[model samples]
Target: MSYKKVSLIVLGSEAALKRALITVIIGGDEAAKSSYLKESEIYENNNYKIIYTPDLNKPSKDIKSVFVYNKDHDRSLLVVKEGFSTGEVWKQIEELHKLTGKSTEEFIVVLPLIHEHTESYPFTCLKISNLFSTISKMAEDRRQKATSTSHADHPDDPMKVAGKPSDSRVNLVLLGMSGSGKSASGNTILGKTIFPSKASSSPVTAECQAEDKEIGSSWVRVIDTPDIFDDDINDFTKKQHVNKCKELSEHGSTVYLLVMHVSRFTDGERNILRKLGEAFGSKVHEQTLILFTRENDLMQGDMTQGAFIHSLTPDLKKIVTKCDNRCVWFENKAPSSGQVERLMHVVHQMLIFRNNSAGSWWRFSR
Candidate 1:
């Protein structure tokens, strides 16, 4: 099937969606043959072919492999078994488009059943029954509209409408050695005291905590994690922390803020990135930004942030270089909204660079 003529449906509940797909494809009376092919992960009959998969974010290779067979059938349905936040769902849609070399209309997003009525979704969502006909009609309407209008006048380009950076959300995960002012920097980003911040020889934040605030047209979720890279932390405990961070960051695009004390780049922090790789995946640095707290120390010494970065030791400079020199300093003691805004701008630009580099349609502006 031509991708331009495909229909995308975002609906509620995986089980419900699957049931509906079976009913539509295999007939409600044909219970004897209503079973998914175990090896191929597909359910098909003479009329329709349905491809089933888990969440899109977790398996790029699998998604790509599945799409290799999508073009064989005219009425194919790609059913995603879980749903993400509105921004994340759109991102997945864009990714699906890129992976399949297709348009947004070629995918179907099945949200978790629990969230059917709780939140406002970015795409037009529907309940389970009569999915095929409903999606077919919608796709036909869109196709007719596209044919009648100029390319610029087509109203259903998902990238143009839903993939704007302003319409998306981001998760800022704070990670670094203990006493690196992660909690304080989190408070600065949030523009209030949400995470606990205080001076002590021991760690203040005993666990991962998250909070969010609206900053103009977007929402920024700040996730403050305890020192998972600490040498003394046991493997089991470290795993727990890492898992918590992942769970909290599961809903949106995550930018890890590697918080550090501006004046103190200790021996422990020298290999922090390596340790971070071991905990998270090796691609952690791709989404990492260096956040230096205690900027007042730099101010007192009349040192610019660039000057400070230029003078970093080889070890610290390697960390900065690995993150593409995307670094920002914060004065947590005297927080300001401008600091947070500037940080978010860097984040926006960073995402834009990544998406554009990957040939994505999502765009961002200052």
Candidate 2:
């Protein structure tokens, strides 16, 4: 999706900005609303949200959530929250990981809200301007794919609704052991030459590379990372690789795109998840979904991935179960046109899983 639609967005802690916006929320003066609305124009209507905030923390929840939110008609929005401290946010998140398991980036956006009419709030002008500036930059870098890429699954209807996502800035991290075509899959998603690839242990990609491209109406970022199972690497070297990739993704990635060649899902392959847990924490697997590549190999080979992963592959199924039965097949050589859209659909559904479980903690595992 093109970010052109949203010119600005503010994400931050509400409690932090509480003292400043309290007066404005309580007074409910028309001038205050008018001022905040005008500032929204500066950002092309940037959306701002106070993450995990208590309704009472600020001067008023209804006063701000419903009123100030509408004043800024630009792409801007004020997100009032139900919780207060960072502890509350993490508590909800940890529980979420428990039930549905944590995805790549659990939460997509966090916006901090600020209001005008802050002459007596001491640093009202400075605080409001700073918060507005921060969100405005984020909003301007945004765009949503306005169209959907759907194929008619049935011959009866030509306009059958295929899977589509609301926001496409979603970044998927292709992680796993070496020689998994993680880089090749990166190339496929990008539809261009970006990351280096070859059948060698050189680890050409010793770091993470974040690249954005327009796919239909959404902007997709395919982050290529160094091998999680680099044998020749030292402990610090592995940490560096993980850190670099995490930074490139800028913490926006919500899906762990595990790209293992369908031909390589062996008992040994099952052990690889351990490295992921080790590298990104055990909870990492909870947010992951296996992305099997070289799908064409399944047809050409004597045995298919599904057939190979029978009762004997309890470990493989264990990994799948950790991620809420989410998985996808991709043919890097001849990728199905719907592959990207399908993966995104899975991502969209994974996001919705959080909403389904309520705005509280959920669990994963036995």
CA lDDT, every model vs. true structure: 0.65, 0.51
Off by over 4 Å in 2: 1-168, 266-268, 301-312, 355-366
lDDT of 1 by residue, 77-145 (tens): 434343356776677667677876867764555332223355765544543222434544455555456
Write down the lDDT that model 2 would get.
0.51
Error of 1 at 311 (Å): 0.7
Backbone clashes per model, in order? 0, 41
Superposed by TM-score, candidate 2 places the C-alpha of residue 117 at a distance from the truth, in angstroms, of: 62
Best-fitting candidate, scored by TM-score: 1
TM-score of model number 2: 0.49
Worst 10 residues of 2 by lDDT: 357-366
Candidate 1 residue runs with Cα over 4 Å from true position: 1-167, 355-366
Using all chains and alpha carbons, the TM-scores for the candidates as numbered come to: 0.53, 0.49
